[model samples]
Target: MIAEMAHLDVVVPPEIVDNETSGETTVEEGNSVTLTCKARGYPMPVVSWRREDNLKIVLRDQGNKKVTVTEGDQLRLTRVKRSDMGPYLCIAKNGIPPSVSKRIMLRVNFAPVLEVPVHMIGSPLGKEVTVRCKVESSPRAVATWRKEPGEQMIISSHKYNVTEYKEGFYVTQMSLTIRNFTLEDAITYRCVASNSLGATASSVQVYEIQPQKTRTSTKNDGDDSRLGNQIPLAASDHDKNDLDDFYNELDDPINNYLDPYHPGGILDNDRDREPLLKDPDIPKSPTGSKTFPYLNGGGGEGAVGIGSRWWWWAWVVVVVFWSVVLPGRVAF
Candidate 1:
């Protein structure tokens, strides 16, 4: 039992750590990340770190680029970017067989960015034209089109359409379609892509191609000769006065024929019914004073005229009858 125990103790390795450092990590840009590599061994093994894919680990803070760390059990990264994401290897071996390693995945999330080229083209009327742009982002972005110098979004309709295509996991193509194109479709159109992080934009110009017109010209000297041979016209004072009178008649005529609601129109078409232009009902000669007589106290009766020398006896009888019948009214 002593010989077996000695052999077992002699065969034990100095570094015999298990693979307990494997994990997954996710971090945003401009933030810090810490990766822990812990292990246990017979002689307390030392830790060394390296990239699994044989790539450079860039330290943007200290200007240390393409570096390899051969020490430290903890791997720290500050201001992590999207390009720093990959599998990391942590190996533990102190002259032992079957070496141990762990892969820690680090994910970096960022905002969307656009890299678009300017394109200008002329399209004919009643045709379809496409305005296309490209984008790159970690998370998928929502795309839209807006008319510039204005921020109002382009409302999709039968003549306008918006679409997107994914070229890769991080690259995409955003486009807009103008169907049955017209002159109004020519504008400075901008394509926008947005996500939780930020937004980016690009612009394209579309123009309407006007059709060329053909012209036919005729050259003839006879036309000028004919115009010269024609009599020269002259306006006399009488013609000018007639023209002025006609214009005045048109502006303020004696009657309005075209007006439907003219009060002067005789709808009955009878001269006796023209209320404004017809003769008045009053007589030319005045009536006798008998129509409304005045009292003559000298004769004790009402007379047709005060100039009359004689007062009729019938007038006295009428005054007595009226006074007796209507005592409440004054007889006149």
Candidate 2:
């Protein structure tokens, strides 16, 4: 039994550590943290530390800490940020058996971020109005105005000529003057405020001008009048008589002249009646036919009716004269 134990001891490793140190770390910006690895082994194991991302290893020691490996074993980080939280590795090896320690994570906490102030400017209508926006955070914020659309914002330049003032945590102001307020001048004015964490935008304020009214005229029977006035009219004697004649003439032989080519035969005729010059509901005839056939055929025979009728009378006069003169001459 003794000989078997001696052979097994020769095969066993010297740096076999059974215990490890447990360290708790909480870090922040401009702060430091230390993680210690106290291990037990037969040959006094050597502790080595490294970062997972291949960063240069650093070590630091405090009071009651001796035989310090301040260059490779103990980790000391200064001015840590929230991003420094990760796994740190520590290994124990005595040139015999290698032992590893569980990873340690250092978390860095910080306060809430303070954002920039928001700037809002009202439009330049002669009408008076208020412009306002708000900012809230521990650290005070600086705000600016810009006109960029769907792009990185820039400060409002001097050319725009805006008046600016600060009110507590918020910044705002109205335009010095609106040169011209017109319908075409309406536009989306943007207000933006930013901080270290992020930026936000306010709803656009729009400017609109009420349309102006102008004088318009409406027609009445004898003269024009505004629609507001309801003039109870009394018809004149001549007007009543003219209207009565107009309606009576509508169905009379004067105006119901049916179109000749319009499939309807002639139904009425009156010499005293000629078609009214302006008929409102009448559809004009494309074929230039006249209402009276006698009028269209050129006064019967092209300007010869009167000459023919008078020609017979002229012959009678001439015969009577000649007969009288010839008989007297023979008697003499």
Best by lDDT: 1
Error of model 2, residue 82, in angstroms: 3.8
Tens-digit lDDT string for candidate 1 (1-332) = 35543334433343423354547877787898888888665555567778876777776666755687555687888888766776777777656555566777776767888766657877999999988888877667887889877677986788788877897446788778899988887888888888888988888889998877875544555676688898865678668889999987784432322321246543334343244223232112233222111222222222222323336556766898787867756553
Candidate 1: stretches off by over 4 Å: 1-5, 9-23, 39-55, 68-72, 86-102, 119-128, 146-171, 177-182, 209-332
TM-score of each: 0.45, 0.28
Give the runs in model 2 whose Cα sits over 4 Å from its true position. 1-20, 57-73, 112-332
lDDT of each: 0.67, 0.46
Model 1 TM-score is 0.45
By summed lDDT, which 10 consecutive residues of candidate 1 come out lowest?
283-292
Q: Which lDDT tens digits does candidate 2 get at residues 1-332?
A: 45543333332333323344435466654577766666445566667666565554332224323232233445666555444555666667665654655566554544333232323334545444333344432123444444435444433343244454543222233232224444333444444555554566554444664546785654663263444466655678668989989877764443344333233323333322224323433223233434333132223333222223455568768898789977888899
What's the TM for model 2? Answer: 0.28
